[model samples]
Target: MDLTMSCSSLSLLFFISLHIHFLVPGSGKFLPFRECAPFVCGDKNISYPFRHNERPTHCGYPGYELGCDGHNPTLVMESLTYRVIHMNTNMQILEVARKDLSDDLCHGAHVNTTLNSSLFNYTSSDLNSILFYDCDSSPIFGSYPFSCPTSGDSYFAPVVDLEHLPQELCNFSVLVPISQSDEAPDRPPPSEDSDFGAPINHAARISEILNKGFEITWIANTAQCENCTESGGICGYDWKRQRFNCFCTDGAYSPTCNGTRVPGSFPSRNKKMGLKVGIGMAALGAGIVVTLILMRALIKQRSVHFDGEMKIEGLVSSRRYTYKDIKRMTNSFEEKLGQGGYGCVYKGKLGDSQLVAVKILKKLKGDAEEFFNEVASISRTSHVNVVSLLGFCFEGSKRALVYEFMPNGSLEKFIFNRSNTLEVDRQLSWDTLYQISLGIAHGLEYLHRGCNTRILHFDIKPHNILLDANYCPKISDFGLAKICSRQESIVSMLGARGTPGYIAPELFMRNIGGVSHKSDVYSYGMMVLEMVGRRKNIEVAVDRTSETYFPHWVHRRLELRQELGLHGITNEEDEAIAKKMIVIGLWCIQIDPRARPCMTQVVEMLKGSVDTLQFPPKPLLSSPSRSLAACPCESSSLQEGNDSSWGYSISIIRDRLSL
Candidate 1:
């Protein structure tokens, strides 16, 4: 009898232990529903779908976890952390503001606020407010101008005025969503006779709108949660199964807890006890595997967050296309317009029947930064003389830039006697060439001073300039461009950049001077000389000793007051235009950076007559001794020591020309 009683006690204890284990959450068994009592998080009552991190996972919906920082509640969505200012459970809306903007609006990372569309969405009452940073001038439209001691001037305006925001005057911009109600309370109604709309207190108005925060409604399993709650069960989530779970006092159910048994719930007490133990063991093993998979996914998410790919997407205003879309638009890389070291350009048409040139870049390792730089630099520009960026494609290693198509193709074929029908048929006249030169000068001037941020195009050559249907020159190919603040006259660079023959002396030889906009001026000078002479600056000869540098040849002729003996100069007017171009090109190519004229001065000189312009000093050195045949058109990594070969004297040519 004693032995039998001991055996019965052991059996009871084993059954009780199994029951308790099944009652616990995440055991893949029946989870008992306990009252998920509401708690205060930073003065706001949090409950149901939104729960603090200290609570169990089943207490809240997935991706809705909140953390407390001091006296405020913080939430992170789409990798951007925000402070929760208010929560309305009934309306299923949350009001939150960016933590970075709240702390330091001036120095925060220049990124737009992005939310997970699957989990939350902005309310209809919200309006986009843009902040233009490092603006050189105020907006033409009504705006609230503010200044940061370290960052310079900035402007804030609504999305309605975005078209008139003056992108040329701002170095960076960020889009922020604000409630229209917030603005309505602070702003006075516009008067009929008012020139500048309503007067606003800059600090108070902006602060109130930002601090009050914007509203976004949560949509994660809302209907299911409501159904579960109405069925007398606590709303929860089955993270392992990735579905809604309804918990009651006895066990967890799929949709509700109205006497429905979960998959692994305990069988009736009369069923076999051994079957229950086997099911429990299998569920435990499956739980471990699911947990491991989730952990790996979490690690991958963190890696992507730090990679900065999302940041790049958020910063650019242009449209983004996938690799498949690129192939479809290009018709499997058909109709190649041109090819270069960086990539190949293909003619493609958009859905709207708009012609575009898709430049597909080569898949080179560690060129991601260059691709990003090109996108960032060119997207900020808006000028008649600059190529328009329509869209872009960035997928893994496949990258491409989509630009408005130029019917005349690159200026290279036209300037150089390339064997193309378009080049022969559309031969550029002297007047047309002069207009192209003036247009290029205007584009450079806009890059240097017209924009809030100065852009230095290290590679400025005819090959990079595209001509439109009307023969208008538009500066293209910003692959080697450097963006700097307007205040930064000189910029720091890791190494020399630009085509070999057109690279400024300061780039390869640091002792000459710091690299600045004047470096671009040097490149422009070489290109103009090439256009004037209708040949390369340095031409390869059968013997290196007899090689002729075009700039040296042109300067010699100009010094002797000789007629520019060249093709296409049929009249005195043509000769005058040629003389004016040669003089301006010479002034731009001065060895000393300070001696080189700025783009603004170059534009003014181009507009003026040849008689008013004085002769610029002769260049100190001719072309380097290196053979032009071996150098590629795009050589960006020329070292400083290589300058030794470029010390050839021009005295021999000068004396010969004087005689």
Candidate 2:
């Protein structure tokens, strides 16, 4: 025990001496920077030269400590706390503003802005001036003035150089930094009749000008990082010592790790000590990553679902739960929420009390293509409108996907009464329906353009639209989703996907146009039109047994400026919202895929005023029978009943035109 204590004490003494000497005895280096941890404070990410208190001593520059006050990140300099607006690592510049300052002059004004000269330098781009508060008399006309509670005594010096200012006219003053353009201007002196006691109309003017925040450039430059980079070491700041710290592959060090000779050129005096340091460094990420990978591989090997497959991709962003946990949380799959073509969703509670919908895939083989596609496609997205994939269970044949449990069920239940019951009890307001349309538009935009990879949700209908607690629409069910490179403009397809009513005209027949993002637009337009008309767009007529497409009927009403016959469209505002949706929806379901607007344009049109929207051409897709009869060539092989996927397809007109 004494020997053990002696060795430990000697190790501590060696560490202290190494820190003091700035070297590791004869090793001629410090230690690796594995201790540093980069993290996000509020919305800002902190790293080298700027760190939170939880970071290590070698993490950031001295005097650049940051702390979070609740959710907002703050930086204290010279006894004043400033809210960090943003920090750019490449520019080495930081934007911060006084936390106490307000954008409203009706409130109060008090600012003490100061920057340590050694650590920060006000770049030439930044504007500066002395702001004096409450002087006996206001300064000359050029000095920006504000009407405070007393009078127009509050004013700021205009010129950047402080010496030119008339010192005799000022009272309490502090040097403040502001943006170059649009500096504060003096408020007009109130006349005798003017109410001095009453706060001015533009009370927020002064605060607004000053609230833009100031930028500060760090003293460190490229030269400091140059030498370190050449020696295969990363240059960083040591906050405690107030100096540069170079983090190297083998170990961290001061000065430069380029010193001495090549690592293999010189023989180490003590190999045993070097081996111990090497082992410590390996455990950080490099060696640890492999160990983790091996353990996961072994776990996957024993799983019934993944036994045949070595690995799967695109599901790394979400968690993987065990079958026992899934069963316990779901109460043995008792509370079934809904069932679809792929699986059944059961309501479950996570350990953290978060309600989740666990979708258990039925009869799927270990390497089912649909299972991978669903998991891989949904996992790549993180948008409010897009359904979030919380976790999954792939224990052999029991494949289940976990998602945030939506309180309200699928939108189909509310929008159209699936049950043939004539119970018109609670109808969703026009406002709620309009908002849902916009939300669905934004979701499609995110999938097609916002994410890293382009995701095309082939199936986009009212049945697949799930509503949450607030009736906000979440686009769910990625059974027919396709992931492609953003660079790839068009995607190839094997067979037709999606419900017949909502499928794009082009997807039915490629001749109309190559399959692109507009396909989803066509689907969204069809679904939204049904929401506006309050009936299935493609209902089978009882008398003639012919299909009644909604976009055509809605377009006719819009063209003639007739009443839409919407259930909740009581007032002008509700009528306008309904009319706006019908117009945009018609534009989306244009027979020629090219005639339809993209999802982005769809969102814009929905947001735009009803007066601005223009009626689209009569939907030719609604009456394909007329076009076929008009065809001069009777032998043209445009068979109607050949394809069951598209019973009322636009391909008839598309193929007819090709003739």
Candidate 3:
């Protein structure tokens, strides 16, 4: 009887445990633990939908977690992004905060950690997916020296406009020092000596500053310097190099930070898992193998699989042949035109005169829906600046798009590629660039005004803007694009979209009245600046001594009447053309989106005299998160997979251009 009672009790306990684990409310059991809600790990204070510990563990995933160190707060997951105070929730959009490292006081004591793809990953368990390395500091215009009279602490703060700051720093975290009583135990000591000697009375100062409500970057020690430089890794310190560690570069790894390995050799648990999975999958495979065997035996009784429903109109016409035909057209896919956002574009000829650019999309699964959407969206619009789609093919699982061949190829070749140095020097003159700029402007205007629904060309860099034989610019790659009607007004974006540098600020804000045609105008302005400077916006301008965004650098040079020199005055015509372009570019990139002229207005400004245009204030290097608001273009170092060669070349080009 005792033994039977024990067994019954054990059974009851087991059942109760299962019920508690699986049935209890808010117990984080079978609830959506695999996909974390956006609010689960963000700032819990400040208000609305932004939440902490509101989601089940399953919903939050491995990377998403609300971290607390007793006093202050932090949110960490795959990518290390910080939020100010989380207050708003109904919109479900969290604000991303960046620290301004240019504050010498903060720079002296703290370090900046670059949480790149190699170091960590961004798991979009939350509604928003952020690219974390996009933080930037203001350029050192002229440094002002300061010494805390009480502690003999001195450093330099790069002189950026404080009046226009709050507008410039909408979505960022400024670290203000606090008094000893308010400081958190987890906070790192300001000095490298392992102890912050005295408590700072920063609350009063912080309150005073906050009362002003100007967005400013406060320096602090949230970064992990010791962890970063522990091994033989290259240390990426703060702007002042006070603290930081060396993590391994590409094709390298080790906690000790020594040695390098081929990409294939990188340690992965997936290999072991794959072996285990193969054994378990063997049983299921046998049934499939037998089925396949039976199907093969009855091959003679089977019908052809090619002729199915062709739901997409232009996807596969009767004239559309098979993959075999595409093979023969390109002579077994022999020549490659170039690679692009969708996939590799191959040069092919249907007949004697009809040359076509065949775009073979990369290996993307379940993209049929997206491909069909793109075709539908692009098919409705027609303009000289927009790439024309001849037709597309979707036979079986393979998909390919055909377009009219631009014999001169993409603008990237002329603007970014060095191989066409001679051709560009002779043919891509200032007049040619101006024409290209106009064509691109017209294309943007058409999307904004001409179309029944305004289309947002999310990606507007030179690479996406192709140049034809006459040097006319054609906007390509409608992927990552959105369409909105004027009546609808606002289109809520999920997280951050578009390329790193060219994305707009309001897009980062939750339901912040997005979908303004002004976003595209801002991107165009950056592109125009690129065309004028003949360099990417992320790269530093040549004339500037330190690293700064090209547009901001131009603003400063213009302020000093030094802007013209940035374009190396070869003659009166070149100087005149460059000056006009710079001033127009500056006006197009005004910090206030409302202040920025519409694309139609931009076209007028470019065509109008430089003297008529009011010179824009110098571009401020605010927090990276705030860049979308003021600068729009993200700096070069902030981009992922940014090759050293790419960064070096841009730096060199800007230097040469500055001459």
Candidate 4:
């Protein structure tokens, strides 16, 4: 039986080799090249390396495929579609324009053009042009003002004049690539004599430049393709093998068509030695396939068992404690620390006499998936500025979280005058306040960028920031936090999060932008403003006759070049620190989320000198009349006077107040 099985296998291998060498046409010689011929889309000629979707997969290089939308050819790269304008195969360059921006400039969503760096690179002949949208004020110097009939105010400027343009005044700006010709001098600046004709001429000029498109040199295996074509063979790619192949009448060869057979291609053989070699090769391939299958099964089985054990251990790790243990650690709830919407907090001590703060969570109706997930996320964080989670207790409805104790408690007590008299008597110095702000910014920066999983502390205010013995600030209270992958730019929320006074405008109004890490920056800005003002941002006057928005008042004072008049400014250094904090806070609270700096930028700004800081534009929500409590409920009333900014502010205020 063993001899018969061996004979059967050898006979099968010989039959396959005979079939390949005789039966299938070009099977051992070449691939069908008729389907890979050059084609035409619109007026452009599409050839080798760039194939239409109708062509076979082997006809084009990977990621260089195109699709036809009616008569025009479109290429989708990195999610943005572009209309092909011209292709220079000799120079390996392509000229294309953004399909969305080709017909109407302001019709699409605000997004900058981006290219895949590995596949294409911008040519030096292309210059960057900035398009500023929803600008509150016209540029004072080097920008050409324009208006979109449907989208209101906008501005345009060349890259050379970026410093002169009022970018801070704009809600958002997009960087677009445009062709720069030597004859035109790169969109000549508007003349001093004709203000009216300048805008019209500039708008037309911008349209022409964008339509002309920009050039990008494509990165491909051009040298290999050229060698293959020079050898009188058709150049193509092997989709299955994921490499270049040259197709000749005799066979398909790699690198070049030099009458060489690729692996697996069988030729005619007449000797016993050749038959034995073919049989051995076939048996070896079969053995390798079988070995791979067995190894894959073993690895998968071990992985499942290991993952199951890890999960079981992770569920009942050292960090988890029983409800009975919590009672003994907290001394039967004897010493109360604080209480909030989540639950009450109590001072506790471990068996080693180490201090801790235990937060007893309220009873939730559903399973504890979200609870355990949040605990796991917090456990992974090890930053000094972030409060550490020591242990947790989740037995039935009784749940609690243990954290490392902060001797100084929350920051609100010291910042708010009415909270603690002792804390007010020993007021924090300006330097201390600045350090706290910088520390909090560092904490946020770590959460946003340094961690494996990005943690968005939706609630970022004075009340959520805790100070240690050395007065170092640590971000606390993850009740409303959202954990997402670091690659995620925007997170989806069912509804608005964060406190009313410190919430970002985009949380309640979708028109502002998506909810992202920028939202946390806004909250941080509001808190810093409160720390500088030493009062609530929106407060009624002592006489109760008028309401004042502190941010607006601070902006007016700065614009007038008057003293900030803040307390604890005994020297020029103190004055400079206060001014720097004010300027940074203003920048963080811009109406459009895109205008706000990231937490990393905020950290850099805090470390830099006051002279390096630029004064931010007037925040749209800074008006006293637009206070969350004062805004009218009717949408029509909010939209009156063609004031879109006011409308957005009113909408945000209404939603936040209702929440």
Candidate 5:
């Protein structure tokens, strides 16, 4: 009977131990194990969403837990070891390099990468997919001519073009993913001659690419975890509770860390067991508390950047890059294309061989507001005439915008010429000029009416027009832009915008009409006038003989039905284009803001015949008083129009006439 009672007690004790391990909730089991920083392995600094060995399961999300193997922080996801390089909370990116792969990466890269499908996915950045193929000498070998030689006869060749390999010599294949630097030169297409081999160094390039590491973005079922992570709290999903838990420095919190003191809200465990667990737990807890207090004090002494603005809420769709990434893309800003009041632009290349122009804004008053404004406005625009906003970087005070590179540069150089002897073939033809004019008008119309909101390009001038390789015009420079609802007829502004010659009269003083899209029309008109005369309208040095304002002279000549006296209007068609542009310009530059046609009207007028256009009255009389010839056009003024300006080359005119 004594042995039976002893055995029964032992069995009951064993059952209770099993129950406590799996079911009973304890202070240490549910709570974070009193740690401020999550990591100290190698050079890695671990933070939110990723928990280390010192942390409880509640401190980090599942599939993101990391273990330390000696000096390296190893992540065992999808049954592979990935060395943690860095983790960025703002970017929500985790970069990990393949630890199993050899350092040389070329001769033998048997290691492969796969993300935790439940929680993460590979970043959408362009990656080169390398497929390893085993092959023997056969007719099919020519398709995959380039080889990764292994044995004396057999080789591993990377075949990109071919889809299938015949059973005669083919063994098997495996695919590997590698992240590459965006600045790598584009590989040229393979030649028809296979034996010549590929130009790009596939082995060295790909190995370097793997060493750079890969990015995986976490995806939780709900934004609860995202909010918790953003609030500087560790986010972890409770497998047993089937809900997200935000763990703060104090203790495990609900929804978020509200700064309230710790409380015993957890399910109660057996009280008899508390003393046994409490004595040892109390000793460990006291040591952890002291360490945490010292760490908190040290961390508080460090300085923090004013980078909070970079994490603008609701700006997630656009890719956010680090300052280091920006430097790499721009090649340390080595090739500067141009510099303006807003920023400096540099030529750059993306990993996929696409050329780009990166604009780094200068630090100035209202820099933060302007940075966000430019991003917000440009990101909403998607048109052929509008420059594309590819990506952006906002780390601390350094901010930048990446755009598609326009080889031809701004239209200022093409339009503004100092010399009269420049050749004609080198210049743009009247036909091309008309099409570009029409394209600009179409883009303007889209911004005004087509977009969900009206975008008023406050500054529209020759300098802002950008031309592509095909001479197609695209509007750029949105530093002075404004957005208003379609219903709001007139937009509000504190002061006048645009360059001296291009700004509308009403913007300076609301005498003509309230500021509206019509203001953009006025600027466009001045630019079109410059395009026709091929010289500055007010006081350009193209010809010294004429002191009169240029547009007034063109108006008088048109009123008299006289010859335009343009150098490039050799043929009937050339003359017709010149007349069309002149008529459009005269209408756009009218002093009365109401008198100027909307962008929609301008587009139609450019498409219509020159004969249908009515001569516009002289606009100078309605402007602020200025010294000029009493008449709109005099003999001297007409002669000045006849002077060979920078463009309007005679050969180009004659060629058009001959055609």
Candidate 6:
């Protein structure tokens, strides 16, 4: 039977060779299999990169080689190379074939292998070494000394941790060759009876198949090791973990192990010394970051900073200004433009004809940084529709801002005054009103989206809008503005941010959603309708003051066509402008934040056809109990005629108490 088996094996080998040769005619090109030599033979179909002749000198990195297992074509790389798993322009990853256990007897064969460090190179600077295994099932497979820092144990189960394994064992799975068996001269035929168990095949039997020191070539620019340098690291084999160990030296830290600091005076020169330094550096950096965060929190807690002059390094410089200079400039508060929550505003001349308005900022229950930030943020932005910052003064317990004078005064003066009602004669033409609308949209657009960071004008109302000599609108009073990331929508309020009547419904109900740039769009829309109507919808109609707010009132009228004066206003031009403004306003104040058009779209509408305008569904009007709050509008500035005739003196608009 032995003689017959040997003869059969020789004949079978011949038959396979003949069949393979017909497909690949060259024999001289075959590479011999030595300890580390490349194997190349079989079909021409497998050539260069995957060759049948001698493996090309540069076919792959040193470890990978093309070979034929007698009659079976194979690609070998170290201990694995199960199959080509992936190949892209940059690199390739292969599945490692598993090694099968043939014998149940432990210690059946002494298989010992060691990697010669000089034979192959490792391509990944991030990766250290390869991990191997020693299984009790296969006695022929010997224990290989790996290069990791930690000793490893038997890991021959089906699912292996790939990340923990070295590059060579990456995707490979091992199985015993079926061709090798103990019966019939140890050469098994392909038939099921002779080919079946792993008992016939063993990794140790095919010594010719084993490779040593496979060199992994540099991936060129393919893999980026942004932080690694070759010098001062111990690049030696670590049998414990079966991977290369790179111990960094010389008071350094980081993945590249390149960051260096001065070493302490005691030079123990011990390898363990670097570990102590690494811990100290990490602790120090953490402490610094923590301290900064705590400092900011403390500042906010101490709200009295707003009452005194704050000397911050980067924010502002401390200085003094005589109150006399302010009195002279304002002519002792003679030309009072308006009065509000902040303080009274007076039109003054700084230099010859350099008209400026001075506003004394209100004292607030907050950190000085909040007040300063408001001034700094607005001062930096320069837009045609935004009020320009003129120099300011910060005296002890007193802070005042100076801005370029808007000669035509506030939008409320021209639009809603019961006495100085020239608005009918100085009617806002459709074109001029449209231009003003575009100007206001442009300013809000800048605040919402154009800056490096988004700013929300929490107090957007007609009084805060000032008209210049040209009737172009400029937004003012940024004291209540919120500075934040555009992505941040809702803000945790110490109190409500906007006025009662104009505030969006979402602002009051925190459960509804967060407030974003869209919230400001809603306020600006309410202001637009106020400007067009030139009437304070809430308090104007004596009886309705207890019923509807401006925005809701506008919606109700439009729904009934009483909005546009459907037949038309007695004054055609004013009526048309009113209709257009009302439509644009509806588009702005949509209750669903997403439904409202952005400021950019608002500007486009003002310039486009009013007929193209789309009106949003009417928001339910808030009842008087929920909407009206003591008519926040204060008593009007008393004129000379009223004072003389009524025997009443002009009660000065008291600072905080008036608004």
| Per-prediction TM-score | 0.51, 0.49, 0.49, 0.48, 0.49, 0.46
lDDT of 6 by residue, 325-435 (tens): 777778887887777766678888875778988886665544444456557667557789888877566654556677889888877766667642454656666657667
Q: What is the lDDT of residue 607 in candidate 1?
A: 86
Q: Compared with the true structure, what per-residue lDDT tens digits does model 3 show for residues 582-634?
A: 77676665544644567777677667766776666443322222233322222
Give me the candidate number with maximum TM-score.
1
Q: Write the per-residue lDDT of candidate 2 for residues 1-659, one digit (tens) a residue.
A: 46445444544444433333332435544443344445677777666566677665566666667888766678878777777777877888877777665434423345446676547755433445446666766543334556557543666543322323455775566666655433345434655112354423333544664566777777755455557656767556753234676666455555567654222121232445555455435433333444354457544655444422443544578898889999999999899998877778899999999999999888663356566777888898989899998988776666788999889878777767654232465467889999999999999999998989999999999888889999989999887788889877677542257887788755544345557788898899889988887778765434222235566667667767777776766799998898889878876776666566777777777888888766566655333332322111122221221101223443232222211
RMSD, candidate 3, Å: 19.6
Cα-based RMSD of candidate 5: 24.1
* Ten contiguous residues minimizing lDDT sum, candidate 5: 632-641
Scored against the true structure, residue 192 in model 6 reaches a CA lDDT of 21
Q: Candidate 1, clashing residue pairs?
A: none
What is the per-residue lDDT of model 1 for residues 543-642, given as tens digits with 9 covering 90 to 100?
3232377776777788788767877899989999999999889878877676667887787778888998767656654343232112111332211212
In candidate 5, which residue ranges exceed 4 Å CA deviation?
Answer: 1-312, 419-425, 540-547, 621-659
Best by lDDT: 1
Residue ranges of candidate 2 with Cα displaced over 4 Å: 1-311, 419-425, 541-547, 622-659
Q: Model 2, residue 333: what's the lDDT?
A: 89
* Per-prediction tally of clashes: 0, 6, 32, 2, 2, 29
Could you tell me which 10 consecutive residues in candidate 6 have the lowest summed lDDT?
650-659
Residue-level lDDT tens digits of model 5 in 181-217: 3344443344622346532234554455455676766
Candidate 3, which segments miss by more than 4 Å at Cα? 1-322, 365-370, 418-427, 509-515, 540-548, 566-573, 621-659
